[model samples]
Target: MKFIIVTGVSRGLGLGLTKALLSSGYKVAGCSRSRSDALNELEMSNDNFKWFPCEVGDATQTQTFVSDACQWAQAPLWGLINNAGIAKEGVLATFPNVDSDELLQINLNGALYMAREALRMMLRQNSGGRIINISSIIGSRGYTGLAAYSASKAGLDGLSRALARENGRRGITVNSVAPGYLDTEMSSTLSDSKRAQIINRTPLGRLGTVDDVAPAIEFLLSDGAAFITGQTLTIDGGITN
Candidate 1:
């Protein structure tokens, strides 16, 4: 059986990715800041699902989380989804230092820690694996109020490109998926006017959903995507185009 790890499995896109992986017949070991009732329910119902509590920004905690997951699976891990992330929005000029640091810690460093640890395990197994970082369209495009969040995501894209080149010879593929505005709690804070503006700009006439994003990640983990690496797959309804 294939094994994969997904961070931030308690809600939103992370939860959707976990469900997709489980449904696709892969055993998933997931983590979040806390175990939510929804995650607990999933764990209880799905024999192939396991959940752990972790603060991905903490290097020690991230290392331990992946170590424990690798041990629990007792098999070669096939893929990793660096899906755990947080966003802080503010104008660039006044974006608080504290929020900037925290955003980088969780959004950028968290994915780095997980991917680094997972890569170690994948290398030892001698069968290269997939690493898909969940990024954002804001990383590539400019948005006035999300300077810190955008920087963190752009960093993820750079990480993916560099890692893919470093590990390509070993069959380990590293890539990123950058989604546009999504209808999740993450975007719920936006004003109705802002949301309407985004929808009007999007050719699809709507924001993305977890379902719209999860399949791209799942595909990256599939054999068909073996030839694809070091790329950022944008799911923004052609907004970037």
Candidate 2:
């Protein structure tokens, strides 16, 4: 069985990806800062799913979580999805004192910690593996109020490329999935008019669903993507184009 570790599995895109992976018969181990009621309910019924309460930004906590997961599952870890992130909005000039620091701690540093530990595990196993970082379209393109969020995700994209090159010889393929505006809690605060405006600009004429993002991730984790690495697969409904 393919064993996978996904972070931020409490809600939104993370939760959706967890459900999809479970339905596809993969053994999934996930972590979140706090367990959601929905995740608890799903855990009650799914034998192949395990959820951990972990703060991915902390190096010690991240290491412990992966260690425990490997011990409990006793399986070769095939994939690691660094999906935990935070979005804080503010223009570069007048951003609040704590905004930039907090956003980077979670969105960028957390991903680095998880990727480090996951790569260590995969190396020891001596088998090919996949590492998928969940970035954002804003990572590549700048927006007015999303300076901190954009910077962090941009860092993630660079990290993915570097890791892909470093670990390619070990059969580990590192990549990123950059998604555009998706209809999730993260984008819920936008006004309906604003949402419609974004949709109008997208070639698909709609905001992407979590489903659209999950399949790209699943495909990257599959054997078919063995030749693909150091790339960012953008699922933006052509918004970037």
Candidate 3:
């Protein structure tokens, strides 16, 4: 049997991805800093799904989380979804160094650490695997007050490209899924005017949803996407265009 590790499964896109994978018949081991009632409910209802507490930004915690999840699954590592991330909005000059540092540490470095752990296990097993990082449209198209958040996501895309080249020969694939402004908690703080502006600019006339992005990820983890790697799949309702 094969199982996938998904980080930041407490809510929003992370939680949606977990449910998508579970429904797609894949076993999932998910991690987050803390548990929510929704997450606990999911764990209790699904035998194939498990949750662990982990601070993605902390290397030691990430290491332990991965190790423990793997041990509990007792199955080959099939894939990893680096979905755990946080966003802080402020122009670089005014953005607190501490906040920027924390954003990068989790959004970028945390993904690297998780990829490293998953790669090590995949290599030892001599089997193929998948690593899909959840990036954002703001990474490529910069925003006025999201300098640090943009940089972190851009770095994640770069990480995917480099890792794809390094692991393709071993039958492993790495990619990034950059979604447009979504209706998740991450974008909940958007003001009414900002939200309307975003919708007006987007060709679809509405913000993207978790449902719109999850199926693409489900496809990436499938054999159909074996030939696709080192690429960023933008699921933004043509907002980037």
Candidate 4:
């Protein structure tokens, strides 16, 4: 069985991806800041799933988590999803004491750290692998109160592109998925009118679901996408188009 490692699997898209991957029969090692009751339930029923508590922002902890996960799976890692991120909202100039440093650490640096460690494992295994970075539509387009979040995701996209070039010949592919406004908990603060405005602008006339994003990720990691790399697959219901 293929072994995959996913970070931030406690809730939302992360949880959805974990379930989807597990159901698809991949041996999954997932981590979050805290244990989720939902993931705990999956563990009780699936021997192929393993959970770990990890603060992805901490380099040491992330390294240890990856090491332990690889050892537990006892197989060469096949794929990695850097899905742990924080959505910090604030205007560019005056936003009540927004910690700029913390924003970069969690969203950008955390993904970088995880990709770095996962790359090490993939390289050592000598098997081609996939690395999917979860980015955002806002990463490409700017918004009023999300400068930090947008910047982090933009950095992630750039990093993925660079890594894809660096690792392609080594049998590894790195790509990004940028999702627009979805019904995830991260977007629950949108007012009804604002939500409607977004939906109306989208060609699909609806907000996306976690399911919509997960399948794109699965495809990118599949053999059919072997020749694709250094690209961002935008699943925005045509909002960006």
Q: Pick out the ten consecutive residues of candidate 3 with the lowest summed lDDT.
A: 86-95
Q: Write the per-residue lDDT of candidate 3 for residues 84-154, one digit (tens) a residue.
A: 99988877888899999999999999999999999999999888999999999999999999999999999
Q: List the residue pairs that clash in candidate 2.
A: none
Better of 3 and 4 by lDDT: 3
Point out the higher-scoring one by TM-score: 1 or 4: 1
Q: In lDDT terms, which candidate is top?
A: 3
Q: Cα-based RMSD of the predictions, in order? A: 0.8, 0.8, 0.7, 1.1
Q: Tell me the lDDT of model 2 at 69.
A: 89
- In candidate 3, stretches whose alpha carbon ends up further than 4 angstroms from where it belongs are none
Candidates' C-alpha lDDT: 0.93, 0.93, 0.94, 0.92
- Per-candidate clashes, comma-separated: 0, 0, 0, 0
Give lDDT: candidate 4, residue 173: 93
Q: Write the per-residue lDDT of candidate 4 for residues 1-241, one digit (tens) a residue.
A: 8999999898999999989998888999999999878988989989999999888889999999999999999989999999998877777787644476678788899999999999999998888999999999999998889888889999999999999999999889999999999998889999999999999999999999999999999998899999999999999999999
Pairs in steric clash, model 1: none
Clashes of 1: 0
Instruction: Give the TM-score comparing model 1 with the true structure, all chains together.
Output: 0.98
